[model samples]
Target: MTVKNATAVRLAEILQTKRLENPIGNALLESAARGDLRMDALQRLVGTEAQAHRAELAAYGTMLARYPEHPAADLFIQLAQLVYAAQPKLRECAKALGMSDAHSSRWPAERATYSFNGTLSWLAVQGSQAACALASYTDMKVYFSGCTQFAQRVRTDGIDVPPEFLAYYDDEGSEELRQLALDVVQNGLDRGDDEADAVFCARLLEESIGEFWQSAAGTI
Candidate 1:
């Protein structure tokens, strides 16, 4: 999809060769070992930049784990959105969600059932539980961009794939969207995050899928 620059390509190659336990965390050392990432990019990456490199984030996560009271730890978590393992609110919310039966009583349906509170709670539960699921700082933007692109297609061209109908934005009230939301409901605070991803897929397919699904809740 995206063509990497020469240096970026080389960096990937170097990273692959390291075969390190924490790949992103070791990127800087690996690149420096291979002498590819240098100068401005290197300084910005290793030093401190608004957008943290994967390795930097990894290192920060590690440091926070070792020393949570390290002054700016909270700032890092808030700014970088590296709440993959942040505590307190996420911990408490996840615990409460865990107490519930999760998917034991519910199964994903063929149409979405919107619950703004439920969805927000689910995001926290999933996001907090699955550390490293979102690998980068900009990962959220990447997700939003993907959904926005598809939303545009539905809004302008009215694209609607049949059967699987992943792009059935116009027909988000379809069974597929409901099915996705159902999966989220069923998965509930499970260890993995695919179900959480499904929630977004349904939500983004039609911005109003939640509302529409909510409006029709219990009818179907």
Candidate 2:
């Protein structure tokens, strides 16, 4: 059954009114029953999503603060800021590299905001950012080496980015990696129940991102 998009509370009320059989909805109700629902993410999930840049930056900060030594911790911190930069430049780079227009459409400019509580939404909006973010966390020496190279590129290439971030745009095999990253992100988001526990999404985020870092390392 397609879950019509709604905030957690609204989704719960609708599920109750319709007596729907959604596991997520049921979980939300259970959380509410236990008075442990994370109403912040749910309430902040809609209308307020335009805060994508702020929200993602804050998320990275929260995660880094929460888990600073987790191999990919610095990667996450850098990638969040990278997403903001890559969000604007992704499509143009995709076009320049002669990638399929179908993929190019996915990286459109106006669609570069975060999608809250929706796996599909996150998949769509942050797809390109996801690709680049994953690339930065590769444990492989070569891929990990690219992180420094990207920083160099950021400095020499000088595309209006800050002086500190080591953001990179790898036209080489980026499309495939991006698609893979998006798929992994989709999997994590799909498994997580945001309506129930807001922290679960964040947790799945760390796990999914950590998975990419490990995969990048293994592929070396």
Candidate 3:
């Protein structure tokens, strides 16, 4: 069955709240936060060097293109829909926080970037492709851990990031989120659908990654 907008939002909210409470969740969230902070700082320093970052995103996108129906892909698609549905409220949140979409022009781009990274990591672990798996896992570990640092930067630098914007990286109380993610992954594994799932997730990642890069370049 296709994932509905309401179901997606509920899943996201549940995952976030549940996942944040676990140690693994904390580690992953913190890592991602750090990466985000670094990206933000890099953007500030280099101004719009979108080309430099394109290669990394491209590599990631390619990896994700391998798994369209993966649990990660399902999660991302849900996230994209939820974010789109919440645009009105999200915009309001951005306005209240005095944040501009200048850094991340569209919600889809933000969702793609965040979800792609996680999916890449998950695929690496599940896929038997030695080289890609190693690289993706390494990148995933670093990205998740970096999230904490990014959150810190937002607080310290007085970055006007809205809560909704932060929600993508918010692992503050996400035990349920972790459980949901785990359930998806385990189910795929148990059903021996891991390979198929990876391919599905990969395809979604590839498309969204390209879209994100295009949006960033166009913005520049």
Best by TM-score: 3
Residue 3 of model 3: what lDDT? 45
**Residue 184 miss distance in model 2 (angstroms):** 13
Q: What tens-digit string does per-residue lDDT give for candidate 1 at 24-57? A: 2222233333545333321121112111122334
Where does model 1 exceed 4 Å of error? 1-76, 79-134, 158-220
Best by lDDT: 3
lDDT of 3 at 101: 38
Candidate 2 stretches greater than 4 Å from native: 1-50, 87-220
- lDDT values, one for every candidate: 0.30, 0.34, 0.39
> Of the pair 2 and 3, which is ahead by TM-score?
3
For candidate 3, the TM-score is 0.34
Tens digits of per-residue lDDT for model 2, 1-220: 7432223324224323432342212222233335554433222211122233344555555544544543335455555666466544433433343433322232212221222213322432343332223322221222233344433443453434422122223323244433333333333334443333332333333333332222222211
Lowest summed lDDT window (length 10), candidate 2: 41-50
* Residue 197 displacement in candidate 2 (angstroms): 9.1
TM-score (C-alpha) between model 1 and the true structure = 0.21
